[model samples]
Target: MSSSDIEFSSSDYAVQLDLIGRVNGLTAAKNFFSSLRDQDKTVKTYGALLNCYVRVGLIDESLSLMKKMKEMGFLSSPLNYNNLMCLYTHRGQFEKVPDVLLEMKTNGVSPDKFSYKICINSYGARADYDIMEKVLQEMDSQRDIQMDWCTYSLAANYYIKAGLKEKALHYLKECEKKVGNDAEGYDHLISFYARLGNKDDLKRLWDLQKSKCRKQTNKNYIVMLGSLVKLGELEETEKLIDEWELSCKTYDFRVPNVLLIGYCQKDLVEKAEAKLQDIIKRRKIAIPNSWSIVATGYMNKNKMEKAFECFKEALAIQTQNRGWKPKAGLISSILSWLGENGEVEDAEAFVKLLRTKVPVNREMYHALLKAYIRNGKEVEGLLVSMKDDKIDENRDTMKILSLQDQNSEVTG
Candidate 1:
């Protein structure tokens, strides 16, 4: 059928929306809705407008139109609500979605695969596995709804993000039982187990390799190993690396923190320092985190000066291009080093220049502490001042305390 040969009616509105979606007629669709909305034509026109906006990722408009269509007495439908919910979901907009769902129930519409998936993904984004599992339970309760691999994959993501590795493994294992041994889920499960430093699971995965049945690569090995390192399962991690004939140097920055940390552990200062530069040579990868790992390694090997330099470079590079300020250690390292170097005045100035984050002025308190101890500059007044204006103990503050005046502070 020709384009004009098509009849534009309520039943056919969705189909027309698909055609216009392909042609990118979003504005035309919206203008058409505004211009030609009589009671008879309004429902279809508004629905078409909603579909067009959703197609173009104008989800707010699609949601707004859903409300207008409902107010105009358009009947609830699986296709309509499903599509609208999907649009809301792609934007990660969950709060608005349940209201549309309520409207669906009010209009006698039933939830289907699309609505179910949206809820799964939204809850996963929030890492609210309790509610995410509830969604799965609710879906299971209704015979009309069904779960697919993507559905279960999303649920598994909820567990992973929430640090419920055991729960993730259980859900993925259930997925395997239900779906006859899925390889992707198994790979992911192994990765999670490796992250948790679960010896039994890691051994099994390794034994599978040793039996001449499973093929492993640096990519996959480091992917798992690096995750374990970040979780700080250091002793188990060392043994695993010694057990496996694995190499991590070739992995991307996403998983190469292991290489950095391993170099630090072995006191391979230059190798640790070069990992960041190696990652930078790759195309189109934002490895701001490589510096953090490198800095730690350098610091461990008594290379604090170079570590400080690397941190500054990383923070400056990250902040300049991406508009994201570094945190968790970037500022802390600077303040800590400035205190150690007895450059408290310079550190105080640097703290003020932080564009987005507020720094605890601990360097001043502790700086004076060191000053009083080293230079004997009157502790009576300084002690009272520090007590009154103490730094609130955050993670960075705690790190400063643990590492202050560390004997291993140096650079190669």
Candidate 2:
């Protein structure tokens, strides 16, 4: 558009700068902002650049730009201050967030709904319930402010965390009154009810959500399913999953993974694996973590053989889920099991596949050495490989080497 005959407005330049920051990194965004003519450096463009700096977590740069924006009288709106509050919140500087709100008020800029919400959240996060309640009261008293379900829900969440059940229920009731037909609002209410272990309220709100909300999304199902699971109602969870499957347009594995996790948490590994296998039988796509979940369940039960089988399944189709990696503790346990009880060839093959995901570590080498020694196989080549990999022999390595020597003496 810059090269075209189209006239670019300040808003267009701001959007372009935002896009550049997101796609090309902060340096490119800074360069683009610098290239802008003085007239083009409007509040919109400056705010966009400031947003970029906040997004990339450049604290010094964000503050410097905010100072510049303030000096130029561009801090007339609540947006600039809100961005700073968000930055502080994101960086875990929750205590500083309220100070930004105070600054906004001091500058004669009235705090918007989001501005008040952020301040409330910051106080809640700090466990400063006195100040949080005071802020909420002030926000409620503001004539221009119309409190939404989200604010009430957020306050209720913090109340729940503080173990103030009555206060939490009050806010939750207010939240429900404002929910109207919003599915996300119902989701929060459902989750909070579950946290409170109020199964009846959970069911009531769920029914209400289904009746009022036009559609129940996958996220909705996940939340409901997870809530039921949290209440230890696997039967209800199963029924909900069936309901979701009947109407869902697209199959999302995360929906079932919720129950899979629930089953494992309840020490029902066989049930979880059986459910996973049932999904696989239907040719439904299950991610690697699904198998890993079952594997972890078996590991906890000390069923190493079963764990090995399930984890092997996870590794076989790992390429299908590139982002999935087995947990380090689980991997270590499996490697140790393979070294002690697995076939020498099996250990080598598993390690070969494992190396692709994690760095070749001392645990991998030790597992291989144990397997080779147990099988009465040659260790010279294996030691050479370890040396090539720059894995220095430690105490465990020396102990395994001593075992290998003892085995050689017996075999000789």
Candidate 3:
């Protein structure tokens, strides 16, 4: 995706395997590349296999395959060097990177801008500005190769990571000048200006990019709005959200409740109360994480009652969509909060509900015991069950007994 779309070829079965692995995952890629090797062993094969393994995060395998490539007389080409540098650079493995560069230079393979980008990144990672500057000087002499956007964009990024904001800004402008009004350059400028906290420049760059592209429609606005919100620029985020409502289709989209309402994450009670209308009006998010965010926000605000309700709502939504029980664990903390807040009756109700939902979950079992303890009745019998260490019986008969007792207490 970084480079231009490669034309599909039979010789590139390994490259295809690598791409598939990157998209799917390392394990999937390994399985795929191995299958390609099995397809034909006599030909020039594993160069792509090595590249794929590198891409899919099989760094050791990629390296081992590099040695194997030499053994099999697959002479190291520019693509081979490029892929190797990419592997080390992407992984931030600096010591390994120089060894590859040394190999390239020894073999009289002239390194290019992208190759130096890896070296700059390696030095940037260690904050070694001296060597980084040396690499930049060396790069200055290689400008006749016609450095592309990727070249200086990487330089800008490297400087930014090195905490040299001025240098980053300079290189970024140089990148723009090289491209002469490219759309992606504008996008990079927007990101860099945002990073620098130059809100005016950021907005200006965004506007320019937006104008060049399609007419700032709903989907595009959503993407931009998310990027702004994630940057923690609350005022800018609000401005974009309001702008979207004015110009674009609202559709069924809604921002995260906490982001929309400025809800304090640790104050779940107040967060839920503040966004209560949004919570109801915005169709529920199937992500358990969103529910947890609201729930935590309410709890931090000591809004225990609202927090409990939010978690329960999230549990139901999560169960329906994903059949995932990950969030059921939150009930333990919620039940604890309920008991602490003297909401004994609510805790008992939840225990009754849990029995009807997941009968054998440990959290439900604990809630049932806690509810009985709250009422000051039949704690002795449950303690006896605990003492017997009848773990499986606890999973079944004892849980049922506690549920029935809680139900009787609640109903009566």
Per-model TM-score, in order, reads: 0.48, 0.91, 0.67
**Model 1 root-mean-square deviation:** 11.4
Better of 1 and 2 by TM-score: 2
Number of the candidate with higher lDDT, 1 or 2: 2
Alpha-carbon runs more than 4 Å astray in model 1? 1-64, 71-110, 120-138, 141-146, 153-170, 178-184, 191-197, 202-222, 230-253, 261-292, 296-304, 309-412
Per-structure clash totals for the candidates:
3, 0, 12
Clashing pairs in 1: 302-410, 303-411, 304-410
Better TM-score candidate (1, 3) = 3
Q: Which stretches of candidate 2 lie over 4 Å from their true place?
A: 3-5, 58-60, 283-285, 356-360, 384-399, 410-412
1-412, model 2: which lDDT tens digit per residue? 8899999999999999999999999999999999999999999999999999899877888889988988999999999889999999999999999889999999899999999999999999999988998999999999999989999999999999999999999999999999999999999999999999999999999999999999999999999999999999999999998898899888888889899999999999999999999988986667888899999999999999999989988888788789997899999999999999999989998999888878899999999999999998988999999999999998989998899778879989
> Candidate 3, after superposition: displacement of residue 288 in Å?
6.0
Q: What is the lDDT of candidate 1?
A: 0.60
lDDT at 254 for candidate 2? Answer: 82
Predictions in order: lDDT = 0.60, 0.93, 0.62
lDDT of 1 by residue, 148-194 (tens): 55567667667877788778877766664543344444456566565
- Give the C-alpha miss distance for residue 305 in model 2, angstroms: 0.8
Worst 10 residues of 3 by lDDT: 260-269
